[model samples]
Target: MNQSAGAAQHTHRYSVEEKIIGLFLRTITQVCSAFIRTAAAAALWSSRLQMLSEQSNFSDDENVPGSSWHTFSLQFGVWKDIGPVGPDRNWKGIGISLLVILVVLSFIGLSIVLLSKDTGSKTSGSPLTLDDLFQRSFQIHDPDAKWISAKEIIFQRWDGNVFKMDMNNNKTELLLKNTTFATFKASKFAISPDLNFVLLGYDVKQVHRHSFLASYLIYNLYTREVQELNPPEVSNSALQFASWGVQGQQLIYIFENNIYYKANVQSSSWRLTSSGQDGVVFNGITDWLYEMEVLHHQAAHWWSPDGSRLAYLTINDSLVPTMFLPRFTGSLYPRGTEYRYPKMGQNNPAVGLHVITLDGSSFTEEIKPPDGFHTRELYITMVKWVAQEKLSVRWVNRAQNMSVLSLCDTTAGSCITKHVMVSDKWLDGQNEKPVFSRDSTAFFTIMPLKHSSHGAFNHIAMISNHSSGKDVSLHHLTSGTWDVTHILSYDESTNSVFFLSTEEGPSQQHLYRVSVMDSSDKECLSCSLFRSNCTYYDAALSSDCQHVLLNCRGPGLPQTTLHKLSSMREFQTLDESAELRAALKNRRVPKTERRTVQINSFAFRLELILPMDLDETQKHPLLLVLYVFFFKFSATIPPS
Candidate 1:
């Protein structure tokens, strides 16, 4: 009996210990499974919230109720709301729960790292949309005449009112209102020399680069009267050319391929030339060949300084060939347009220069070409009045290897060759005009720099008009390794010639002043003027060199300023681009980098514009742009 009791007690104790061990393992499995479910629910909720946040457009004053932490807590409460422990907890459930929790937590941490890596750093700039391209902005128009006097400047506002800004206080005064003249919108206008009338061009159609056909209206400033400018013979036809005469309210215009004159508004129009025919001949206005190649101007006419004489070219194109171009405008059959085009070794237009006196008698004379040129084949490249009765003409051979600058006696109707420049290559005299001195006894022009070691560069040379014979005495006025681009103006008071030159750098053009008497007294006017903003400049000086209109282009936004010519101080700002600067305050703008690379003896200029937020370590695609004969390379990277 004693042995049986002992065995029963030991068995009971072992059974109790096994039950405790089982209970401990079950508790652990349940805890782990709960944790895994909670973790999975948390990850799923986070992903949903992230997606919603990305899709939502939140305003500053609005709140997102679904993204609050309280929502997350409520979701976790669903697991806790299920009562105490279940009896089926196992090791397999614990293992799966732990594995799932590890994966979800790892993924969440990786996502957090990736999203936070680029915070506070800039990304590539946004690409331009169609809206950016087609949208219009407020812009200031460049003044018609560069050297407009402060008293004569009149600006047309967007509301169709004319205003004049005061230079003393920067105040604006209304000159004309749109309500006064509602029938016409002036596309271009010019003030008469007397400042009493405005020549307005309306309903304009462009015919070429420098020519237009338009209906003209003359507005009287004092009387507030507007009248159509039409001759009695062709009342409704478009005028070929209309421009202000040198004096009073006088005007000259071209019509029906011929030149016409008006001494004043009340005077009857008089025809100056009667040899004009359609497609065969043109008077006072250039034909296609002359306009394209020789003159590069539509009106081949020039008025004398005193407004007494008019010199013009008469072009005969009857022998030239015609080229037809097709005009397509969504039509069933395309229309053809014909134009006179002179090809290589073909028949060119015959050109002649004629002068007409504006007196009541209407005397006319033809200034014949020099004896050396074939008048029919040669080109009358340039013409200018050097004096009241003397004119300067430049004539070039058809071979383009020789050019002669001649002085024509208008009274005698004869031309005398004053100077001749010959070039083994082609002489580029068509675009250059000789600059005469104040006394008209000497003239300046650009010639190759003698004994230049660096390379061939153009410098200013003076030719004496009082030469003994055909051989004129030439003197070098300026010499350097740099090239003078153009002669801006001559100041007779100071005896100084202002010009543009590439003296500071090859890509830079700055205003320079050099004395005609000294030649060594040189000054750079624009190099240090706008040190940071402008690298290229052009200037228009008043007749007396008292005022200047300076055009600053490049390196930054372009600016136009009115300045005192003597001091080079800014008098007024014409255009400051205030609207454009305000619009670009928050946007990314292109940045330019200019570099010069030297290969052997040649230097190539390169301009590179890279994308914003450029990455140096990554390879990027590039676009290269090259202009023929310019040797300029530019690269632009598109935004990603």
Candidate 2:
């Protein structure tokens, strides 16, 4: 008896659903058919009238009055004679045809309104205007803070004064007054390792992406004294770059393409290289190809952990071809400037790795590239100091499909290949600095691993550094369908590696910590915090890994905060962006939806920024924004 009742209910439900779908389809079909027929009839009569006028020789008469209309009227009369020949009959037929067309058009219009109502129209709020995009109503506040120590951070306030913030007590203190170095109109500043001296960069000028030229001044924090880095007697002595060493107040600057070293803020500068040639050889800095495609940074120098030895690249572009770009403004004749640009199958910059000692006895050692690259052109993509006596360098072939990571002995100037990565497709320059374990026996880097037929996703991979040559083994530290975007820091105390990953979704980035000893012991740090507004995030960990500086960037107004990792509690709110939140509360804003679509055998991440109120039945224009950088490609579609 129960089986019979169940079967009857199922049959009734299926019939009711079928009837509803049938009614919808039939209504659509009837309205469309009627509209098409009426439109076709009107179009036929218009085309016939045009054809008759074109076939008549009287159409060419220029001295005639309404000659084309007269021809059309004569054709109408011919048709009328075949039918019920009379003036009133002709008028009556046209009126009836127009009435039928109007009725069909009205029916089609009414059907669309009904369909929209049935589907539930999403039109409620105002639509975003063009001005809203250009002049964004939603403002994001960034602290632009950098960690100086485990419990301290340094940031510049809006008034240009630098402040020091303590993570423990949530207290802020002014470190440097804006007016102290305001005479030079300083635009950039870097604090020394001891946090005593500040290097002020002024009169800044752009060279290329992530590179600039500026005049620097050294400011004493206690004494409040300032002095120019370059001597006043020297003509046009702006430096290409300046940075403090990892220890004390040791300074290094590039002037006239040569690297110069200063023992301290009061010491005189000593030249390190004299082979710098104009537009030919670049010392301690990257050339066009290296900065644009390879290293993606201007600085080509690396200091050992103890700051005793320095490793730098001497790029010789004398053999490479030069391209002259003409400037047409501000002169009667155009001015041309030459740039070292290597085209396809051309000579790239000859890159040589050199290590120099700075402990009293100054000497230089040239480290040769790895085997199979001595006779072939190779690009230096990464350089890092693994130990006081050892440094790591990554070398890639001309096609960038193969990469070799070698650990070099700074004292002996000899390198042993530790790991090698090869791919059929081009390799993304591994520009990330690998975090070495406490014993320096292993290092963590991001690599791709195939997971469950979703294709390969980026995950954290740890390779044994103690093993030399190409026989090293890579162990997976983190795994999933999502990708690990960057490695933030490694804590030796907890044996945990912190990194940013798209574990939540592709459009969102959150912080995650995984134990190197146990791959399954992983926890998300930022997933539960600020769940409503913050989706994308960037974080920086202090040297001791006790605190984290987090930047919450959009799906809403951006926010910056500091957190104590031990308790997983928010230490402080740096910027709440209350003004921006208030401004957007009453204004219309675009909404973003993250979706993943499968095409063929590949899955692609798609982000759609739709209008506030979207009507499915109405036609809307689409705008596609494509961004291509390095080997990465992303697409954003917005309503137009």
Candidate 3:
């Protein structure tokens, strides 16, 4: 019985030893599996990190995703929580740890590289500076601003080459090349009436408000020849005025204040006036006062529509008071320049309206002013040839309160007043040239309506040119609350008047066509017909009224466009400021807002400009701009 008990105890001990061995083997297996899993995961993560790093180096996209260092750290922490396997079996764990560390390092390197690249990209395209802003703020003129001939726009480029662009297809062709003439370059140019010659002004020096002294050149289109327009007596004297006559290649110029004429390129120049004296008398050209206030033109001359006669103003400023202007340039002592400038209630230059025949008949006749006015102070505001033998002259009193429109019979040398308009305020209608009817029996002018809702808004009126007294009947043509800002043209074909008005709004100007036969028939041509981006507008109509050059001035970017009148479709964009817009695409710009405030009986219009990215929570300084008439106010805000 004792031997049996010993064998049983031995068996129990063996059983316990076997169970412990089995338990160790199972634990070892589990550790090996965990190590294998950790190693596999590290390899996978390492490969992924390497792939992501390579992609980041060459990838164009910035939103690519990769294993972050935090995520790797969290994963590594979880793996570490599993604890290192037994030291005898921890080799796989160590290798996995090394791989994970390499992946983390790679991720850090790639992240730094990506951040640097982003910073470099941001630093490359810098913001615009003050100098850049000023440089780009210059006005870019619409090439077709001044001269458009025969459906073609003519302009001179900076290189002094003249080009003509066809409005039909926007095709341009070189018309004249630069011709050097004695150290002078062509600075201004105008085409002839027949488009056969280009009159060029070189070495131009501005003298007064509207007058310039320049040497002249005549460029022949057919022969491609350039000729100097120098008078025989003077070698290089600057001409006061050089312009094309109404006839084909006929030229008229003023030298030293005297008028000279040329029938053609090969013809000799003849002196038309010999009474011109420096600072005393000016013939065929305005003095400083007339240029500044009355005519606003350099030449005070008019050519007959048939090109048969020339009407000019002979201004005598001998008795007018002299004003001195100081000139400060490259000199220790400033020199005072004396000019005849008449102030209010002072004696003005005596202006006379004279008509001279261009047919070699030295017959010059003067149209006397009216019955009761001092000739010395009476100002001849406008002179336009209405017919071959008749001319329209406007005379305003020295006080500028009363105006008299007279029709002068050039053949009879007699002037008769047709209408006398008296205004309590200053009369502004003297600058408007009346549009005569086809038969010259009536003329159209913008006159204040007797009864209107808008309080003395100017409207088109047809007045008889036959009446000899102030009782002439005036027929109202266009009656509305808005004022007709300007009369563009009188279409004889349609018996309609084309004008620009503030009919749309005070801030906006649009073209309108109104019929004289039916005063109620009017059409707004440009109100609803822009590219949804333009607000203010100005237009230049073709001679035949078949096409119009529309200038879209902005609340946005300004652009010039050509359109067909018949179809009202955009032909082409002449100047869109594409380069300027492109440069400003990524730059900050100021925001503008317009509002009108009514204070008592006065309504004041104001425009505000706010800085870019303006925050309402922050305080901003304000600026108030005021002008004499306060017609428009524009503000600019700098970037923060």
Q: TM-score for each prediction?
A: 0.72, 0.72, 0.71
- Model 2: lDDT equals 0.76
Backbone atom clashes (below 3 Å) for every candidate? 0, 0, 0
List the candidates ranked by lDDT, beginning with the highest: 2, 3, 1
Error of 2 at 224 (Å): 2.5
Give, for candidate 3, the lowest lDDT window spanning 10 residues: 79-88
**Candidate 1 residue spans exceeding 4 A from truth:** 1-140, 148-183, 328-332, 467-471, 583-587, 597-601, 607-640
Report the CA-based lDDT of candidate 3 relative to the real structure. 0.73
By TM-score, the better pick of 1 and 3 is 1
lDDT of 1: 0.71
Whole-model lDDT values for every prediction: 0.71, 0.76, 0.73
State which candidate, 1 or 2, has the greater lDDT: 2
Off by over 4 Å in 3: 1-137, 145-173, 177-184, 328-332, 450-454, 465-472, 553-558, 578-592, 608-640
Off by over 4 Å in 2: 1-141, 167-170, 180-183, 231-236, 326-337, 465-472, 578-603, 608-640
Worst-scoring 10-residue span by lDDT in model 1: 79-88
Sort by TM-score, best first: what order? 2, 1, 3
